[model samples]
Target: MIYRIAMHNLSNPSDAEDIVQEVSLALLTKCPDDKDDIAVKHWLIRVTINKCKSFHRQFWQRKRESIDDYLHLEAPHQRGVMDEVLELPKKERNIIYLYYYERYSIRDIAEILHINANTVSSHLQRARKKLKSILTEGGTYHD
Candidate 1:
């Protein structure tokens, strides 16, 4: 569950951990006495996504630093590719994260993101092109 959430959100391990903790707490508060495990899981996932969105909102409100800084500081060699990925428009970012990270099919990604499958595919195509160009320039993949 943690892996899926992290992948779908492109969240750092630390942030994922924090969100998971928040989800756990929220579940305890919100779940009814007779809620089944399946319902609990669904609620947790929804809460987790909400928490991630909230976190991003707060993070962006503070200041406008280079996204590259996050990439480099977190992982230098991988930073180049990550910088480009992070630079994508939010919709593209969400689509890529859902498809690649979460290992979701295009249909599933579209459902989760509440968009058409074709839109998800288009975003992915553009994201791939942008990532390829950005990484080719000064990415860690340079040999």
Candidate 2:
């Protein structure tokens, strides 16, 4: 799960692997002993997001490229609707991945992301709208 989030955020496999390793080390050295499974998962996700944000900033400091160029570098199998999902704004992509792929409730997503539940809902709605448009235009995805 952490790897997927990092991959989606960084769009680079090596960076994602590094983040997973960093997060795992942090978890091993600092994770609270009393936290339950759900809490641990939430903590891991939050940490992964922070690391991804830091990496993204560093990447921008190094260079810039068109979205099209980045897309071209994506794994060959991430085509069609998956590609469109990858094209989403970071926040929306996170929400969509958690809500649909991870099956996280809006409230759960809110707590994990440290945002209001209504905000999570709003992000989901907007993401769905954008995905609907993209998929429909290509006739590649449907309800």
C-alpha TM-scores of all predictions = 0.57, 0.78
Candidate 2 on 31-132: residue-level lDDT in tens? 898999989999999999988888866744344333344445466555555667877888888988887778898988999999999999888888888887
lDDT, model 2: 0.79
Candidate 1, residues 10-109, lDDT tens digits: the string is 5365565667777777777876768687556545555666677787866543443454444235457566566566678767776666566556778766
Give the number of the best model, judged by TM-score. Answer: 2
Worst 10-residue lDDT window for candidate 2 reads 134-143
How far in Å is the alpha carbon of 45 misplaced in model 1? Answer: 5.1
Compared to the true structure, candidate 1 yields what TM-score?
0.57
Please give the clash total of every predicted structure, in order.
Answer: 0, 0
RMSD of each: 6.6, 4.5
| Weakest lDDT window of 10 consecutive positions for candidate 1 | 134-143
